[model samples]
Target: MEYEILGLPAWYYIAMVAKVLVVFVWVLLTVAYATYAERKIIGHMQVRLGPMRTGWHGLLQPIADGLKLFFKEEIIPAEASTFAFLVAPLIALVPAFISFAVIPFGTTITVMGCKIPLQIAAYADKSGGVIDVNVGVLYILALSSLGVYGIVLAGWSSNSKYSLLGGLRASAQMISYELAAGLALITVFMVSGTLSLQQIVADQAGFGWYAWRNPFLFGAFIIFFICSLAEINRTPFDLPEAETELVSGFCTEYSSMKYAMFFMAEYANMITVCAITVTLFLGGWHGPFTDAFPLLSPLYFIAKVYSLIFLCMWIRATYPRYRYDQLMGLGWKFFLPITLVLIVGNGLWISVIGAGNWLGSLFA
Candidate 1:
């Protein structure tokens, strides 16, 4: 069959490349609009207009910002390691882009007598499945952990004391949240009994979402959500990039495209976390009546993910930032122990009786 690339006509590679280009362009555009969406949403919360002068309430704001950054002078400190400084952002941004390749954007469709799956790589393809590996959850955890390295390298290479401090703080923060995040994931693995994201989603098809199954697992999901924010350096846990303290934190020494790379990584990470949340706790691409109409499943999933993203932006605008000490205390003193207890409790409940009976006992 022409399904295999080597057996296909010469135009097959062109078609593959074209598809990639389309997705890449879409992601780039989505990143631009995400900035505008954040500003507009935050502005409403703060009772101030944001970027009105630039193209119809800041619609073109991202374009302007991109152009400005593009034309801006690229600065390198005399004492800094220029190579590492220049390379760090690419290292950060590439993984963010690559991570999306495994994401099942949509299901299979028949076109011109060929069955093509909507994903960039079909799960059946060994190479693409490496991207969509059975160990997807672990891949995400590992990649996200790698994100910290870019910030660290950027800070150390900048040769600035403030940048170095911000990097150190980021390292500590990522480590702390990573524990809660991983533990919360262990709960998911226990419930679904699979390390594969696809299998997890499949397990939720008829049975309702694990998030609503029991209080313990639900609590773990909440803890996971909050810790994910801290891991991504979002507000309330944004100590590393505390502008008043660290002068834009680890990226303080970066300019132009280098600075943009950090923002790209941040937003992309946000999307990834939200998608994973939907996949693990919210039953993934499953929704009411989705099986009856498979084509609509991905849309439902995307909507839910974006809604969560919007909520995060709203919280960022409405709430005051927490003190650094308070941030650490909440993560360590409260969330850590709570999540630990929940995991243990959930395990005992599941083992004593099946998950369904445990749920009935709790509410009955």
Candidate 2:
């Protein structure tokens, strides 16, 4: 039983576990504040004050929310597949968190005489391997896409019509948007000449982000952002749980912790998409002159990611819900075609310009 983490001694297993624990805690805390940030931003958008009572402009609102959900009566439907119902949320959430393990957060640094890459466990000789997978973008897409299963299962296992319909809607919504998202990501890979997220970030090291690469990338960014909203089931694209129509959608019959699991999964997915956007398009932990002053890189990366998250919250607060058909039409008729053409155009443009070599040199 000699399990090692990143080729380190087996004793580092405890440190790996501790590392994951810390990330879990961070995700929980981030989700809590994301709710708060959404409220405050939306409140201001609607010309009203946001949560200000709990703790200094409502910092403790998430805590209040946790207490509320905790004390709420637990309800399990008599006809539900009780075991599957209970398992769905965990299935949905764990993968969302685990995918982050492969995403490199920052450059390697010497900490306490140990070299550390701001990433979690990677396979030994991580270069171009599963741990530091060259197909990171695809891996993220695959993992995030799998999240739909948990929702679908929860809805089916609930044995309720509303829940079932909600699940179906979610399945369709995620599937459609994932197509556009995949195409958009392909455009990034085309322009950057790599599928590895770390390499993508590395590519953006000197030159500005892919978002600044050109107007085409801006279009891709728009498509990616919109698709992410649908993928994460956020407002405007939140037809699955449209309170007026579906009565809380798939989790209508879910209660207590089950409901909380769905809630947590939503936020976790949000973070995942945000992280993906940062890594793929905005440049993961790269910054100006980072090779000279490496410390600022991670800060810049965090700033960009949080800013993107803030923008998501802003959109949630400002926009009204879309009609279900409108959501689908946007994905199919509009984003899909545009992304397809853009990806093709990107490939053509890259070929003409010699596969990012010219761009890289010019930027360098």
Candidate 3:
């Protein structure tokens, strides 16, 4: 049997390992700081100082928080299932981190007369990302759907009424919103004619970004954003963790680093959703000078993601939490119908004008 990848020597595995390490470290750092950014931004929005004492305006607040959690006493409920309770956070957290594997962060760069992808993996000469699978969208959807299990298990295993209710609400909420979110993205797949996220980004290169190029997709983008908020349990849709009611919801029984894992998972999911949004609607890594200087692509991508994250924070500060019924209504009643209409309308429009041709027909 021959052992090779893309006809490269076995030593290539070493490079792949190094790339994975880099991405994992990068994502961890980003997730940590995203929490700090959220608190600071929301504090300022409410006319209050946020995290001012930790390190020069709380620059090192994430680090301090991490250390605090690390040293905290671990607690497990006497009545909880020993194993499932212990592993629930890992199940929740790992999926959020892995979802970023398929996201295209930047373009390829030439180094020493050889092309190197900014992401961990590449498909021959086509696209750069970590494992550019044919069903990239499906992969993400599957992993995201799996994240609900951790919450459900945590809630059920805890034997607490509040935790169980929180878990049930989370599962129902996520399932409802996932349908709308998937339907919203169907328009993008219909137009792009492929499930590969990197290809979707490639289709939007130059001035052909979907959000501006197709008017219908702008609606889809909005739908996606709303559903994403519900999916991530952000403010205005945070029924599962309603402090006034559920007492921290499904994680009521968790403490120490296990609790921190759930917290990190939430922020990590936020980062993943923001990155996916940038890739799908805002044109991942596409910007002025991106083509001329490939190194600038990542900068553009990260800036756009940060902007979206700030918007999420702003909404958190501005809006009160929705009642549970209202949250479910928004997903099932509003976003579902809207996304279905947009999907059908987009499909018909694409069928009429053809993929990547709508832009030219508008000016014609």
RMSD (Å) per prediction:
3.6, 3.2, 2.9
The lDDT values for all models are 0.78, 0.80, 0.85
TM-score for each of the candidates:
0.89, 0.90, 0.93
Best by lDDT: 3
Q: Which model scores highest in TM-score?
A: 3
List residue ranges in candidate 2 displaced over 4 A.
1-18, 123-131, 355-364
Q: In candidate 3, which residue ranges exceed 4 Å CA deviation?
A: 1-7, 125-131, 357-364
Q: Tell me how many clashing residue pairs each candidate has.
A: 0, 0, 0
Residue by residue across 1-364, what tens digits does model 1's lDDT show?
Answer: 4445575544346545655776577677777887889998888878898889887777889999889988899899999999989998887787777766655555444455444444554433433332246677887888888888888888889999988998888888888889888988888888888776666776666546788777788998898999999998888788888988889888999998889889988888788788778888887777777756767876877787888889779878877777877878888888888888998998997887556524434554
Model 1 off-target regions past 4 Å? 1-3, 6-23, 124-132, 356-364
Q: How many clashes would you count in candidate 2?
A: 0
Q: Candidates ranked by TM-score, best first?
A: 3, 2, 1
Clashes of 3: 0
Model 2 worst lDDT window (10 residues): 122-131
lDDT of 1 at 26: 62
In candidate 1 the C-alpha lDDT for residue 326 amounts to: 84
